[model samples]
Target: MKRIFKFIENNFFVIVILFVAITLLYPNIFSWVLGKVHGINIMNLLLSIILFGMGTTLKFENFTEVFKKPKEIGVGLIAQYMIMPLLALTLAYIFKLDTALTAGLILVGTVPGGTASDVITFLAKGDLALSVSLTAISTVISPLLTPLITVLLIGNHIHFNPIEMFISIVQIVLIPIILGLLVNYKFPDFTENLKDYLPAVSSIVICLIIGGVLGANINSIYTASWIILVVIILQYFIGVALGFVVGYLSGMKMKQITTVAIELGFQNSGLSTSLAKTHFPNYPIATVPGALYSVWQNLAGSILAYLFRKYLNKEE
Candidate 1:
């Protein structure tokens, strides 16, 4: 079981890809996982579980790290909120995606950085502290930024209430994180024991979320695969390029630059997926980009991390 879990952890992106492929081929197989009861979507429950796991891994020190280096964290946050959303908007227009795809891509841009960035940053010999701090701070502020940005950019295309979206983010994200933090603080030893298994569990939950979304929208995804793929690829790579530019122009160190680049490039697509499913039921295809991104960014980030590590090693 340990070896099996280790394999899953190491090949996280591969598992996601395989699951997504399988779902696309056999939609009903994974589609059943989207079962709901009493008007509540099962994805909401799974998302809460995923967020709770994320909360357990965090510590008070992660928050303090932000204050310790406000300049670095602030720059990272600025790049995150500014670069990605605007780039997404540009790509959406340039590609001339319909309202659903445009909103989906923009939402992906607006959300916080994923924990996967921390892993990639570590692999690239980047500043783990900055990565964690960026992710934590960005996540903490997502309730305000994500909905506001969405409304500002894609409001004309979609009819969503920003207040309701804010409340949903708070309920799905902030509250779960706070609960996990309290548990971690109250039961340090127990949390420590659980931490080892959290990654594997979280990876499975993420794959399930992707599979559910992909299964639900298999037909739409097939029809729009090329356009969505092109836009998502552009969105990620552009964010990476702009992230490095921001860090470089700001006089950040290479390690910090690497951290910023990964942080800005990768997003918490899980949150985006949940938000789309919960809030924009009319546009089911909106969840497609998030599901595809949930797989693509990690694979791209991992490959980039390897190259950065190799280059850094040679320099040393």
Candidate 2:
């Protein structure tokens, strides 16, 4: 049973793709997961659980890496915020996306790095400390930066309140993470015991979240897939490529380059989906890109990790 769970966690990108296929073919299968539970969204709750799990693995010392490796972390921070959002904005304009998708894509760009990036970085034999630090710093700051940037990018076109979005992020992203950190702080042994299993659990929940949204938006998938699919590949893969370029140009080492590339490529897409549901009530399609990205980025990152392990590692 433990081996089964470990396999699921390690091969989560495969699991995500399987669930997405099942959801797309039979939306009813996972459509049930998309509804409300006592007026709280199941998707939002599931996403919060994922964030909480992330918080558990983190320690306060993670932030201290910021000071210790300022140049690397600083470069990552600037590139994370600047590269993706600008790529998203440029893609949105080039594709002439609707307000819903424009907002969704930009949100995917603006939010923090994903915990999955740490796994990818590990697989690529990159600097895990730098990856974790980037994720931790970005997650801590996301409540402010995510909403502020989303509104800044899309406010003129969309009329959602940034304050409300900010509050929602704090509720959905920040609070759960803090609670998880507190639980880990207070009950270190318990969290340590669950560490191996949490990734698998989080993977399943993420699959469900993606499945549910895709299930719910079955109609939009056919139409949106045509354009958004192309945009997703471009934005995420280009982000990864350019991130590597950024690292090289910054004179970073090979391991640091791999970490930077992965961090920039993977976004905290679940947060983006939850925020879209809370704020873009009218544009249900806004949640689609996040769901799509939740799958595509992991798949891309995994494949990239393989290339790094195979080709790039030899160079080092």
Q: Estimate each model's TM-score.
A: 0.96, 0.96
- Quote the positional error of residue 123 for candidate 1 in Å: 1.1
Candidate 1's TM-score: 0.96
Best-fitting candidate, scored by lDDT:
2
Q: Which 10-residue window in model 2 sums to the lowest lDDT?
A: 307-316
**Worst-scoring 10-residue span by lDDT in model 1:** 307-316
- Over all chains combined, what TM-score does candidate 2 have? 0.96
Q: Look at candidate 2 and tell me the lDDT of residue 128.
A: 92
lDDT of 1 by residue, 1-316 (tens): 7777778888898898889778877888867556787776777777778778778888989998867888789899999998999998999889899888888888899999997898898889899888988898899899999999999998887899999999988888899888998999999899898866778887998999899888888889889999999888878888998888998999988888888989988999988988887778898898888988988898899999999888853363
Evaluate model 2: give its lDDT: 0.89
Clashing pairs in 2: none
